[model samples]
Target chain A: MASKKDPRTPAQIKLAKQLGAAIAEARKKAGLSQDELAYRCGLHRAYMGFVEQGRYSITVATLVQVCSELDAKPSEILDEIGH
Target chain B: MASKKDPRTPAQIKLAKQLGAAIAEARKKAGLSQDELAYRCGLHRAYMGFVEQGRYSITVATLVQVCSELDAKPSEILDEIGH
Candidate 1:
């Protein structure tokens, strides 16, 4: 049986972290804590923490939720990456 | 054990489909087939099909891969979602 292991590449991991940092900065600028933002976005606090820490591979849908709660545009958040 | 069902909302599903359509448009404009794009991105063709069909909740990393293959930006693809 072939094992299916899709480990993220280093570049992918770095990108995730960059995205997380961007989200954290936006959340702070909006005066929201991780838990508070998570609650407002209907996400689990721990999951939100993971998202902020760049430990989770976030979906576009989830990104929209977070961006909505932060009152920030998706482009604003993504623009922070690769910069 | 508590069930951990994180079903996507209708809005999320719609957004995913929109994103998918945007990707398909970009890919076509770039003159790349789904399989060719998938091959370049190291993704399965079947999975690429699902992504084009907007049937999958794509992760940011995967989105980056597809965008890279399409020579497009994340913002460009996302901009098509809510319009």
Candidate 2:
């Protein structure tokens, strides 16, 4: 239910995009599709897509759940991204 | 405005605590008190304490903002914590 017009700053938006890409990369490496990952994380498929597109703000809990499903550490993906 | 009874999973809760500690450490290293850091991040001081206590769920934007103020990268703090 997040709108594109949400008030995230430019830096935050950049971080989101970078983080999203990293998650998507991890999911791919784990041989999982967006829908599959979403199902595993108990997140909606649409929400997963939105997350990958950086159109949504991800909470810490959601990030952990996604990483657990992908056999990835949140830091693995996060560290790969530039601050 | 978050409660200890938040519906986060145990894993999420652990991650939150680890993350909170890392942030608190960063703030200390920056020589900033919780109130000072919260003021810099435009967050309420009480909310900052909750975040430090892992009693609140942090969004990506908030994490980035906190990191920016602390001269810490999200990944730096996240990677230092055990998954």
Candidate 3:
């Protein structure tokens, strides 16, 4: 394995879950299946699931792609958590 | 690497750079050196540099931490990109 960073801290994971919840809400509103959204974003469906579960630290670019697909703004999602 | 994902696409990189630029601008306005910001975020100076250069896909938690240290809202930074 290559060099890896430390695991996400609990606080970080809590924030990530908030983000994931926002994304999930947006995706559901957009009526796209998680797999469909992942396909559109050129990501694996499993990866998308992990993102939704707050199990992964999604990149900014990926967030854009996901938000774009859902017609949701990243700011809107960030706003959900008062970020 | 273990089950690595693909490298960022050109479009993704462009978007990343834009995000990075906004963050850099905010960091500068906050009067914090890159190294100082990195220290506060518990990240390596080199990683922070890459983030500023749009070479890294920063996680949401890290972004929040960085923005918190800058006293800038993540919403404000995403607003810079119309995200």
Whose DockQ is greatest here? 3
The candidate 1 chain A region of ten consecutive residues with least summed lDDT is A74-83
Error of 1 at B21 (Å): 0.3
User: Which candidate has the highest lDDT of all?
Assistant: 3
Give per-candidate clash totals.
0, 0, 0
Ranked by TM-score from best down, the candidates are 1, 3, 2
lDDT of 3: 0.87
Candidate 3 local lDDT, B1-83, one digit each (tens): 58666487888878879989999999999999999999998899999999999988887778888999999998878878878
Task: Give lDDT: candidate 1, residue B24.
Answer: 94
Each model's TM-score for chain A is: 0.87, 0.90, 0.89
Q: Please list all clashing residue pairs in model 1, or write none if there are none.
A: none
Q: All candidates' lDDT scores?
A: 0.86, 0.85, 0.87
Can you give the DockQ of every candidate in the order shown?
Answer: 0.45, 0.66, 0.68
Q: What does fnat come to for each candidate?
A: 0.60, 0.73, 0.87
Write one digit per residue (lDDT tens) for candidate 3, span A41-81.
88899999989998887777778889999999988788877
Model 2: colliding residue pairs: none
What 10-residue stretch in candidate 1 chain B is worst by lDDT? B74-83
DockQ of 2: 0.66
